[model samples]
Target: MQFDNIRGFLFDLDGVITDTAALHAKAWAGICQRLGIPWTDALAEGTKGVSRMDSLEVILKSVNRQDEFTMAQKAQMATEKNDRYQELITHLTASDILPGMKDFITDLKQHNYQLALASASRNAPTVLKYLGLSDVFPKIVDPSNLTKGKPDPEIYQHAAALLNLEPGQCIGVEDAPAGVASIKAAGAIAVGIGDAHDLAQADVVFPGTASLTLTALRGKLEDGVLNA
Candidate 1:
């Protein structure tokens, strides 16, 4: 909205820029099946916008199995899931980028807005490369060393810092509640790309990437502030 003060943009990887959310779900489903954990849409949704380990914990705790695995076992499971996810993403191409996202990025760059990837995925760079967007976002927040993930402001804050901008000067685009919460916690505008009711906390909500445009975003502002 308005975005007069926004100098940069922080983006999540999965549902925001690409359709890899389905790939991630498929990987997790494989893990669940192997572990005999009942998989459901609710469990899959819980993994959105979170780190791999956090998602694993979510699945484990769903059935009171969190304490069953040792650190090494959990690590192995995570690795397996990532391996599957990576294999699934091997077919990705520029055509897989969400509708209108590339154009939106171009518009933002044309307007001199800095951008960075703030995804929880450690494979963010690889995914970007596959999408032919490696140069589009040179600064991707390193998830490996982050002390906290989405729903904590650390990742968004780190992304803003990478751009040499304050959190309030950036817009965070997310398709999950955790990511929206993180952006809001970081004192940035939260732009949700999903169901309005699901992302009720966002400063503004759009149904999908196809609706993400500077003019449309600005039109959502009321007195220079976003109207959710």
Candidate 2:
């Protein structure tokens, strides 16, 4: 599981690196309820970290409400949720940034590790910029451009290429099962940051980022922890 070959890191935006998922789930659930659709737990979870349109598609299919929603209604509902999402995210402060993300990014940069933001969230750029981590990752592959969402390799592959590294030469850090699958599918080693039930595809499972400092991560990397 050592990552001695790792030249860069590919990171998922939501949950792993940010707290936007709860907001999104709340918004999606509200929209579904308001539209008279049953917002089931499985439906909300399956759509986590996915794009707005794709999330809607999954939710609709889950509730068997695809037949109930017209294309126009779907668009309006997505817009409504996104509007609320935007408003909610705009309220984010530095306190909202995860415990050690800023220091982790700073340490990584100082160590010359290439960084990339590979998020299924379409709102990634604005949120990252707002959180002041925008400049940390020079490469980003957001949800809008991916042909297939998470559980698909396109986003991770695209992200590695954008970062100018081979999938084998980079490590993908993710929280969701779909993101882990995407990383493995892209030929990268997946490091699960939380909730192994959703991240069986990952190579390493770490409970939380509190103990995931750069020194600790580098220790694991040197010990052959990631792709060993």
Q: Per-prediction TM-score, please?
A: 0.97, 0.91
lDDT of 2 by residue, 1-228 (tens): 555677888999887777787889888988878867787778767887677888998888875777787889889989999988888888876677777777777787887888999897778888887887778876998667778888888998999999889998888888788888889999987888786565666877777766567777767667766532
* Each model's lDDT: 0.93, 0.81
**Model 1 Cα lDDT, one tens digit per residue, 155-200:** 9999999999999999999999999999999999999999989999
**CA-RMSD of model 2:** 2.1
> Candidate 1: global Cα-lDDT?
0.93
Query: Candidate 2, after superposition: displacement of residue 30 in Å?
Result: 2.0
Candidate 1 colliding pairs = none
Quote the lDDT for 125 in model 1. Answer: 93
